[model samples]
Target: MLCRNCLRATRAAASRPAIPLLRAGISSVTRSATYTTSTQASVRHTLQTRLPALPTFRTYSTSSSESAAPPPEKPDYLNEAESTIWDRLVAEFEPTELVVQDISGGCGSMYGIEICSPKFAGKRMLAQQRMVNTCLGDLMTNWHGAQLKTRAP
Candidate 1:
């Protein structure tokens, strides 16, 4: 330990500044100092040289056998006769708001209706629905089921 060269090396190490120790799992970006452009470029080059190239992908061509017809258009939920139910209710009730949905999965057997009208202001829920049923007439018999929700304007 008394050797001149060893003594010089120890003095040199003691004179050098201390580096802050990085904690485990800490990100370098959150450090106080920012990297220079040269440092960033060197890092980019190193990463590019180290990583393997991705496999090239090929484009596919559709053959005549693989080409099929486009899908058929979806069928209408409410046909002309089914749509008239809304019109009849509108004509009779003069509702401020009306919405009718065919919930029969395109069979047009069941309908859900929401009607808001001044006419329903003094009427009970059953009476309001009965009026709608009466307006539907023979069409009501044709329909398998209906859900009626009424509101006063």
Candidate 2:
């Protein structure tokens, strides 16, 4: 008598159902059998073998109380041009405190500024100076010059 397995194999050979052979060491069978074999290469290409999902990033927003109010606007005595340049520098540096002294009268339109910013952390003195210079590109063009003193927070 013919074997049942042999009969099944004969039928399968006559009308073979499409099957996919994945790269060695990968899944033996496609996730869905109904998908055509042409998709197998793409499937294999796209499928990521089981791996741990990356940790999601979490962001926390600060309440007004959590952060201090912005610094009071500079006094009226401060030159408008000087104040504008100072405010831009302070905002760029996010300094603990910035002091801009206009020595322009003595030094021919030159100002001395001291900046303290957490952003300056780990940078060399030259790099810190360059950072301030880069931020003040527009202001620098208008003013005759500046003296930068930067400190890391």
Who wins the TM-score comparison? 2
7-117 in candidate 1: lDDT tens per residue?
553455456653342333323422113434454355446556756788999999898456633322223565776568777776687776777888888787888988887
Q: Write one digit per residue (lDDT tens) for candidate 2, span 1-153.
A: 335763453456446564544544456653343544455445444454543467999999997566744554566777776787778876777677678878878443788988777788999999999998898786777678788888886
C-alpha displacement of 137 in model 1, angstroms?
A: 2.4
> In candidate 2, residue 55 scores what lDDT?
97
Give the worst 10-residue stretch by lDDT in candidate 2.
30-39
lDDT of model 1, residue 9: 38
Candidate 1 whole-model C-alpha lDDT, 0 to 1:
0.67
- TM-score of the candidate numbered 1? 0.47
- Report clash pairs, candidate 2: none
TM-scores of the candidates are: 0.47, 0.49
Count backbone clashes in candidate 1.
0
